[model samples]
Target: MVGHVVRKRLYILVFAALIGLTALTTGVAFIDLGKWNTLAALAIAVSKASLVVLFFMHLRWSSGLMRMVLLAAFVWFAILVALTLSDEFTRQWTPVPSSWQAQVQQQAR
Candidate 1:
């Protein structure tokens, strides 16, 4: 039923876009983006997901309320990812030396 609803041209274009994005992701993997590698990959991934949701999932023709719900869901997901990444990025993994070792050795004497 869904396939019967969407036009052939639209499907063809979406397929082409998906293929192009796949090639792009592969190409980007070979590039040195330094700290921006994750950001660039994420951006491309989001674009591909959006296209799939809009066309393949038929959300583009869905009701306004459905679109609003999807938008809200995406916003919530972004907030969660931001919060998690902030915590991750700000964490210090270095081990700090404590004076307890010296104190323990002194006590042993």
Candidate 2:
């Protein structure tokens, strides 16, 4: 059937996208982006994942329910990242042990 043929082509496209993504990620790792390293990697990963979800997973032609499921997943992922970063950044304000402070003070003197 034509649908089957088209689906096969889509599969090949998805495979190519995945291979390109891998190469891009490898290239990115060699670049000294400093703080942007993670951002770059995540960007490429998200792009590659989007392609997979859209084409390979057939979400592009999926029903509203499927779209909602994908949206929910993304929302949950964002929440997790936000909560983790909030905890990590706030940890900087936590008190250090007295012994550690004493050692720092001794070093200063």
Against the true structure, whose lDDT is highest?
Answer: 1
**Per-residue lDDT of candidate 2, residues 69-107 (tens digit):** 889999999999999999998875756667877898999
What is the per-residue lDDT of model 1 for residues 1-109, given as tens digits with 9 covering 90 to 100? 4433887899999999999998999999999999998998989998999999999988988989999999999899989989999999999898757688988998999
Q: With candidate 2 superimposed using the best TM-score fit, by how many Å does residue 31's alpha carbon deviate from the native? A: 0.9
In angstroms, the error of model 2 at 98 is: 15
List residue ranges in candidate 1 displaced over 4 A: 1-4, 95-109
* After superposition, candidate 2 runs with Cα above 4 Å error: 1-5, 93-109
TM-score of each: 0.76, 0.76
